[model samples]
Target: MAIAGALIWAAVIGTLIYATRERRRVQSEHAAGLLILWGGAIIPALLLGLLLGYALWLMPDIRPWSAPGEPAGLRIEVEGEQFWWRVRYHPADGPPVDAANEIRLPVGERVEFTLTSSDVIHSFWIPVLGGKMDMIPGRTNRLTLRAAKTGTYRGPCTEFCGTSHALMAFSVVVMEPDAFRDWLADEARPSPGAGAPGGELFIANGCPACHTVRGTEATGAVGPDLSHVGSRETLAAGIMPVDVEAIASFISKPDAIKPGAQMPAFGMLPEADIAAIAAYLEGLK
Candidate 1:
């Protein structure tokens, strides 16, 4: 179309020049006719450009992998925090798996995400696959995305949450349906008990003031609900991994892992206590 438009424009210009050269007796009329012709052509092109731009702006995001019905495979809760993201995968047929920094979705299946925040406002965005949705405290926002291709996509917090906001990022892994099911099954199995010291320290110290565990007495909601913390992929709001060592270090000093994080450091605890806490959290998966 652009090539055709260029050719037509060239023809119009050539016609104007030819009329100017051939019609000396009616030069004024020829010039007026040329002006009118050019004006008429230019107006429509400008209007078409404007319309196309407007359409692009107003178009809803297109995710090629999404099936055209309610998502049937998985529902994940993504909570944005200052400088990080918390990911929770709720299996359609099994229990939820909690993690930080990473999200997994089944290829060719629709996945729904419910976004929320623990503190200030944030926006969730995955550019290649979906649109941005705000995560406001005390309220939930919904976003749906599907990965037509089996590869990793990077996502970040489009809304500035805090100082370390630039570090707020996560990855979505789109895998085959069977592989995703296997991963969920593995995450569901309980971890062996080896984190008793950490569990005891979690209670002895004041970590339960702002977190929660569904089956336990620690039921605080001021922070990200930690009922399934061990199963999560990231922590400190997608700022760090949810592994035993990372959990231990984060509990020892959250500020070190995520600057300006609201969680206070518990480095004063003995190494054994921190390890125990990390072990217990790892078992939550």
Candidate 2:
């Protein structure tokens, strides 16, 4: 457009010069110059308008209501704690499966999320696939999203929750529907040879006073619910992997991993008790 405008301007100047030398009528020269100037200005304006319109059309429209054909059958609960996301998957007839720092969803299914906060305000965001929603205490917000394709999507806290908010992040795993079901089934099983021992220690060590595990005696809700801890990918508010070593480290020293974490350090536990507690949590699939 700029090039066209410049060419038209040059042509008008050249025509005026020629008309002056050849003694052409003033009206004819004036009409030609006006036509060129108007054309030059109008063309670019039209092109710019078209470009902006196209961009607006391409952007996704987020409505307060869910979109058509979007998955509504799958519901997940996400609880924000300090700087981490505690995820829970609702099964058809049983208790919800608990996880931290990672969320798993079936590919090609519309998944709805119920967002809440244990303490402060936080935001949940997955940039590549969906919008951001707030996790407010004593209130629940809903966000519905579907993965058209299968892959891992990274998300982070969109709100400034606390000192370690910068490190708050979670992953969305979109798997085949059948695979997701299998994973859930696996997570439902008690940890082989260690679940009972761990459950006993969890209560004896005072973990049950704050955390809750439905269908069990640990009914405390002061912290993130742990009914399905084994299913989670990471722990400590997304600070470490949900593995034996990471659980041990978090149980031993939480402040070291997350400075402002509300959970106190249990470093005084004997190495054997710590191992037993870690083993029990690992069984909460």
Candidate 3:
């Protein structure tokens, strides 16, 4: 498109220079009418029509949907919250795997995403994959994409949703098919830290009321799943590095770190208990 525009600009300049030449003859009314009719109107109309037609031809490839009665091989449901993301992976042959903040895909596989919002509107965007899709409250949207590369990419909330919109981002990890399958299988199981000392403290402090860690008694639905949070590349929806200190800081003062976050602050908790909980959560990986 840029090349086309530049070529048209050059043609216009060439014409202008020719018309303004000192030895140029004044064209007849008939010649002027023909120039206006073709160059001014018909040529531009043809160019725009061609561009529109080309875009229409590419729409299906860009946003292809599955055929009726044909289920997607892998469907991921992602719910957008005020300042975070809730992710659930549904494989064709396995149970749903709940995750948060980070998304993983296998190279060369077409994955379908079911997007929605819990509070306000948000836009799910991964520029390397394709265009952005909106996640609207009370409405579901589907976006299909295929990853051809193996690397880590970043996706952010393109639509302004709230105070922490800028902080709401996720990491996309594209891996080889075999590695992805192994990772997904491991992700489907309970966290390794489910029964550690920190896990006990996590339960004692009413953390289970909002978070869930499989293979243990900490099962709550108000917040993102922490079953494998330690395995994720980033913390707090990609705002902080995935480390014990970052986890402890967010746990102690979520509201201070992310304004408008729904999770209440736990800064008043004992420092030892907080550190233990962070260590336990980190061990989940």
Best by TM-score: 3
Q: Tell me the spans in candidate 3 whose CA falls farther than 4 Å from its real position.
A: 5-31, 68-71
Which lDDT value does model 3 have at 199?
81
Off by over 4 Å in 2: 1-71, 90-98, 185-196, 213-216, 283-285
For every model shown, what is its TM-score relative to the native structure?
A: 0.64, 0.71, 0.89
- Model 3 lDDT per residue over 21-41, tens place: 997578899999999999999
Query: Pick by lDDT: which candidate is best?
Result: 3
Model 2, position 62, has a per-residue lDDT of 37
TM-score between candidate 1 and the true structure: 0.64
| lDDT per residue (tens digit) for residues 62-150 in model 1 | 33234479456678898887766677888877777765566778898778889899889998888877778999999988777767888
**Window of ten residues with lowest summed lDDT in model 3:** 58-67
The residue-by-residue lDDT of candidate 2 on 1-285, one tens digit each, is 578568868977986777679655566778877866775677668867887886677444333355588544768889988867777789765667765678888887767788999889999998877879999999999887877888877888989988889778887778999999988776555334334666787888898898876556787867776767766666665556788777888899888888787889999999888987887787776
lDDT ranking, best first: 3, 2, 1
Clashes of 2: 3
Clashes of each: 14, 3, 0
